[model samples]
Target: MNIEIKVAKKSFNYSGPKNWEETEPWLYAKIFGIGKQLAEKPHALFALPQMIFQIPTNVLQFLFDRNAMRMVGVKDEEAQDEVMGQGYALLKIAQSFANSEAPFSWKVPKVKAAFLGYNYYGPGDSLGMLTFEEFWFAEAAYERNDTNALIAVLYRRDPYRKQTFSEELTEKTLKDLQALPELTKEMIVFNYQGCRLGFSKKFKHVFPKKSVEKDDEQQPKKTKKNSGGWLQVAIGMAGDSSVEFDALRKLNVIVALQMVENKLIKVKQLKRKTK
Candidate 1:
């Protein structure tokens, strides 16, 4: 949304984000960085105008001060109050935009001509079509907090067809993604997180929740040894066959997860029978 204010024969126009979908990634970063400061210091509210509008510091100071308003021919108290009210209204709008929660919509917008005249597209709204390899690499990238890598994994040159995963292609695509606008990167991240959330909900059994108990004060806690991570899981699924592993990775994520769940259930059943 755009708002324009005319004061002392000069016009100042500013635009604020209406929602997460419309917000730039850099702006979101700024808002997140200042969130704690905004909470702790009421004076930090003045920073909002600068962030949202890119307003000059001197202009902001002049606009924020009542004495400055008087010097600029806004001597009438009522007029000054009205101008201040507009400023306050703009601040409120900005704050609300920053504070609003993002809706869970796993719809990633397409990036046209990202590289080699190929339009890159994300998995569908629920990521139902994502292959196991794609999901694995994307999840890994997300864990590492590597946005470029995540985007390269999630988006593909073909929208209607599945493509084989290629390290060379992914490397080249990552460079392309880095060159794109920050807003595009932000949107992709937002959609990717939403997709991940949906995937977790859909595969709740695969991601069983573990409750951690607090350690005793007098005794040191015994830490559990780490099991092998995704690499181990992939090896187990492949059963020492490289071809089988490649095929498994190409399987749809939902199907692969179901296979895992079924195997786990069978393992439990066998244990019960033995007992």
Candidate 2:
């Protein structure tokens, strides 16, 4: 089945403190470089948690068709499936960019194609997950400057913005985030933490459930079944604030969905053990 992916572009008009063109490009280069280094001979993991974790809006549009999106009283599965189809595709682009082993000098053909495809997912679309939109792009976003420093141009400060993320929540987010390696967590936190911190119930914002189970929560972002594993990098010096867990969880879900669709990960049902 052919899915219609459409995106329209216009020069950003949101007025604030950010000069996105100047700052954002540097951040993007920073993330691609970090993610590129994290990649290995075949698979690598670069540390730019926030950069890639925060899906570029253009890419997201292709993943989710805003024109077809409508929020009813309650979440619906069919609608979710439609959105999920796009969601997975978008996440796949992020992961592929982060996981590919190509050097900084060599851009993968597929990745280049993905960026071109994303440029097409344009102004016609509404951002997926409104809560994240509010936190990352809303008029009063919690974070001022993203890794790209767009926040600096968006506004100087919102005394009201600081009112959103509380002390207790920040502590929890930090502790959980601490558990994740710098290399692995930076990309997750930088791009996702701001949004996830908004909701305490959401698993660091990435796991299916906000309540992290010891068994499931500890699972590495990149799992190795054999000798190969992602290279280690400090997620901290990543230069972006660590994001909430839920956002990371969301990113992971996005990645997992894409892997499944791309046949990178196979789906299987765990049979209930007879008591």
Model 2, 219-259: lDDT tens per residue? 64543333211111112112254563344323432233233
lDDT of 1 at 212: 43
Q: Pick the candidate with the highest TM-score.
A: 1
RMSD list, candidates in order? 7.7, 22.9
Once fitted onto the true fold, the runs of candidate 1 whose alpha carbons sit more than 4 angstroms away are 1-105, 113-118, 217-231
Task: Compute the lDDT for candidate 1.
Answer: 0.70
Rate residue 28 of model 1 by lDDT.
57
lDDT of 1 at 218: 50
lDDT top scorer: 1
Give the per-residue lDDT of model 1 (tens digit) for 139-251.
89998999989888777777754557887878967876677676567767766776666555665545554434457675545544444434456559789798999899888
lDDT at position 88, candidate 2: 60
